[model samples]
Target: MANTRSSLKRARQNVKRNTRNKIIRSNTKSTVRNIVDLVKTKAQDALDPQKIYSAYLL
Candidate 1:
């Protein structure tokens, strides 16, 4: 249990940050999977240059 006010506040912040991090991590994983699938299914000549550029920007 948190005994001090500061400790309690820190604990709450940690929970918020953890949730935010999880969301970001999940999005990154999903984006990577989508890019991989696109690369596999599309021929090199048929792939969109903008898509590859956007993936690098992410």
Candidate 2:
């Protein structure tokens, strides 16, 4: 429990940052998983730089 005003505000900020980080982490993991699946299913596209770049960027 946060008793002080500053501590309470800090706690709230931590919660918000945690949720934002989780969202970013989830997106990154899913993007990697998608890239792996693409490589396994289509060897040709995997070699193409543009395809991989697009996958990670978008």
Candidate 3:
């Protein structure tokens, strides 16, 4: 158990940040996989440089 106020506050902040980071990282992975699959299908649109694919930015 955290005996001090600061310790407890830090623990709460850590939990919140970890959850946020995990969600962002997972979404990035899923987006990349989807893009890769689209590329494998030989979709010319997927290869276009003009298209703004969020996965590419990640």
In lDDT terms, which candidate is top? 2
Candidate 1 Cα outliers beyond 4 Å, as residue runs:
44-58
Give me the overall lDDT of model 2.
Answer: 0.92
lDDT for residue 45 in candidate 2, whole number 0-100: 74
What's the lDDT for residue 2 in model 3?
Answer: 52
- Model 1 TM-score? 0.68
Give per-residue lDDT, candidate 3, residue 17. Answer: 100
Against the true structure, what is each candidate's TM-score? 0.68, 0.67, 0.66
User: Which candidate, 2 or 3, has the higher lDDT?
Assistant: 2
Cα RMSD to the true fold for all candidates: 10.2, 10.4, 11.0
Give model 2 RMSD, 1 decimal: 10.4
lDDT per residue, candidate 3, 1-58, as tens digits?
5569999889999999999999999999999999999788667766767654765787
lDDT accuracy of residue 1 in candidate 1: 59
lDDT of 2 by residue, 1-58 (tens): 5489999899999999999999999999999999998888688877889999999998
Tell me how candidate 3 scores on lDDT. 0.86
Q: lDDT of candidate 1 vs native?
A: 0.89
lDDT of 1 at 58: 100
Residue 41 Cα positional deviation in candidate 1, in Å, after optimal superposition: 0.6
